[model samples]
Target: MQIIEQQIKTKLSSSAKFYGYIPDVSQEIDPAAERPSVLICPGGGYVMTSDREAEPVALNFVAAGFNAFVLRYSIAPARYPVALLEVASAMKLIRKNSAAWHVDPKRVIIAGFSAGGHLAANFATSWDRDLVTEYGYHADEIQPNGLFLGYSVITSGKYAHVDSFKNLLGDRYGEPELMSKVSLEKQVTKSTPPAFIWHTVSDDTVPVENSLLFAEALEAHQISFELHLFPKGGHGLSLGTSATAIKSNGYGLEPTVSAWRDLFVAWVQNNI
Candidate 1:
């Protein structure tokens, strides 16, 4: 899909600071038509986004008949809620201008892997209702049609990166209540968006338990979801790009961590 380059530097919660635009992509099949959209959050453990996070995934979204935006959210030297705010704002802007971009405000999805996965879950679960009540924003203002957590971190208790929490909250993590509130697992409700999740069993960095716990919560709530756990790839093996992806060309994405990309595409297409 051919796209125009748009770099929009938007405001953070502080409003005084500016987070870079993080390149975004748009496609109008017809000059006067709308399509599904996706907001891509890249992973870097709160520091940087991997190449795989920013490029390949964004391209795949585009090829799948959707408008995709790769959010180069602010990192470490910056803060946590900052990245969260940037993503929320980006979503709001996308929705507000959905008509111009030919996008279906109701079909917008958020996807991320690893740390990016963490934020994706947080924004979908944490920011959804609070951003509405606190800011007087309508449900239309900030909403995600669905969630795609690729080897993500949804719970903040056991498998979280303590250092990342420190960088994002400074002194906030000490507030156990606040931490619990932000933990994605605690926020699941009968109303949480439908989610499609995948992670490897061998993952050690963030742990597959993050996906397990979140998937469990979704099941309990009866929300629609699909989980794929490969046998042996470790953490960050997004869609089988791990040493396993190199070997089998896919990490159970198909079966034994194989053809996952295709599996995800098939699911997304049928659902959307």
Candidate 2:
């Protein structure tokens, strides 16, 4: 395990954020191996990145024979495109260093939880435009091959995750034009990458409808995607196990919900 951390320098002066993770070197296991990499964005509703979702998720991917990185993107007071640009920069850097990292650059995927899911979804939909061009990067350089979203916040409508958007847009939160622009379900297109999405039907924070709406859009566009709506679970389950729990008693942990990780890896192997 080779650990590395770097400051992601993007077009935004204030977006001097950091990304950290352990790189997978295939030579150690099989000299000819080159594995897919996952860039993880943990949920914090655009206010803060969640610790439970960051490194734990990365390690899980690593254990599944994939290289992984955890991104600490900009949050509240940073504004839109701040965190977005940071994600792009992180992707660009990972791709640029693919050889040394034993990575399959084209198979690089982005996985996010909760509000971070919104960011990942938005990036999947918007990487080809807006900030990619502004940062002088080809869309392919930062484009995710697939998106893995966990209990994501994908709507700005009736089921909107209000605080997430408020933090993302700052003063522009309620401006119809900008609000609609970040309403990810409306932004989906045929160009959006294939996705693996999961959510709890009973999630009170972000709602299952958000994932349903996104899945419907994916279906309408003929994009390949897999969605899992668990019968029961709460928001921010992270790994849904003691490993991700911040308390003494396996807080927020649900055995059935934790199984999503395995299902997700299988989906990636089969679909993307």
Candidate 3:
């Protein structure tokens, strides 16, 4: 609940600006310190990053006995490959400094919502293919243990999340094969890490089809994936705090997240 520590400023790419929410690791560094780490990317349609998305989500992980790094990662203004490379670079830095940060490099996870979710999905699937060089990074050097996508935009150009694609990837990304190239659903393979996704059917911003489609891909690949589709609540339901949204299942966004957090940690313990 306190800003006990921080990585004041950092670089995502040579020219792009980015920041991260590296929580206070001093509090949990026992003699046998070991815990999963998460990198949280927030939604801003790729145009901007929601600091709230990065900050609050990290704190929640900290509460769950994990070291969380919240990315105030760059936005659409900086463009696609830039944001992508930054994520890879950040993962490298975190992995290199895992000892000092008190995190287990093997248990790193990439998580995000909406456009941020798209990036998380991209990072997961495209770790081996940073095809465009604007954002310079060696994919072989960085990888995450899993993905946590919240209403991710997995379909590229054709069925793309119009606004998010336009803002983050530019209007040009909407061009046929380009959208499919970036679509995580289209990119899925047996090698993809496990994933956890949640979205509401009522979300109009990115549409539920996004997650459902990607979920189908995960199923086809025989990958381990978990999904939760809520009945109501619209886009940007960050904490599922919607007045009209029902919590009758005893798993509203907030409570549901706590359970998922446990599931995530357990999954890491078992898988990683």
Candidate 4:
């Protein structure tokens, strides 16, 4: 295994970071083999990136036959479009180095939790627009083949996770028009990538409605998607396993919920 960390070059230099977990040449028999990749965006409601969701999630993806990356994208004090732009830059860099890393650029997936989920969904729905074009990248260059969202923030309304959107909009938080603009559920189109979204109905932080709302939009657009609503559990349940549990006490661990990982791998096998 090889680990490579680098500062993602952006229009404005910032603290945003990108890390890749790739297989070394010796690990694979075929030098020309290209594996599907998953780029993870750990959620911190835009204030910071969570440690629980970063590497552990990447390790699981690696164990599941993927070259993985963790994106610690720009957070608060960095407003709207900044993190989005950073995501675009990360995709470009990954694709740029795809060959050397033995990654399949066309099969790259973006997975995020909480606010990061909002960002991933936003990228999926918004990538084909001027947001990426201004950076000299064609939409396809940065477009993800699929989205894996975990307990994500999908709305900007009453059920919204207030702090997440507040940190995202910054000074523009009160702008009703802008709030609706970034309310991702309303933004989904036929062009949106296929998605695998899961949320626990017991989650009070971001609410399960966020996922349901987005799923409805996907259905309206006739886009392919797989939605899972676990009857139990709460928000921020990274893997629903001890590996990503908040403490050794098994904080977020739940047997049934942990099965989401296997389900995700199966979905990837059939889709990617």
Which pairs of residues collide in model 3? 46-76, 156-179, 157-179
C-alpha-based local distance difference test score of model 2:
0.87
In model 2, how large is the Cα lDDT of residue 141? 79
- TM-scores, all candidates, are 0.82, 0.95, 0.81, 0.96
Candidate 2 lDDT tens digits, 91-181: 9888888888888877899889999999999999988888655667788778899999999999999999999998899888899999898
Which ten residues in a row are the worst by lDDT in model 2?
Answer: 16-25
Stretches of candidate 2 off by over 4 Å are: 14-17, 23-29
| Candidate 4 local lDDT, residue 184 | 92
User: What TM-score should be assigned to candidate 2?
Assistant: 0.95
Estimate the lDDT of model 1.
Answer: 0.71
Worst lDDT 10-window in candidate 1: 14-23
Candidate models: Cα lDDT each = 0.71, 0.87, 0.70, 0.88
Please give, for residues 115-234, the per-residue lDDT of candidate 1 as tens digits. 888888888886557666664446667778888888886767987766656656675666888788667887888767888888888787778888999998888888898888777766
Can you write out model 4's per-residue Cα lDDT over 40-74, one digit (the tens) per residue? Answer: 99999999999989999999999988999999999
Residue-wise lDDT of candidate 3 within 1-272, one digit each (tens)? 22323332324456433344444544455655767888888888877776556666676678777777766666666666667776776687778777777777678888888898998888888776653254455554577788888867777644567777777667566576766677778898776788988887777778888998899999999989888786675577565433213357533354333344466566666766
Rank ordering of all candidates by TM-score, starting from the highest: 4, 2, 1, 3
The Cα RMSD of model 2 versus the native structure comes to 1.5
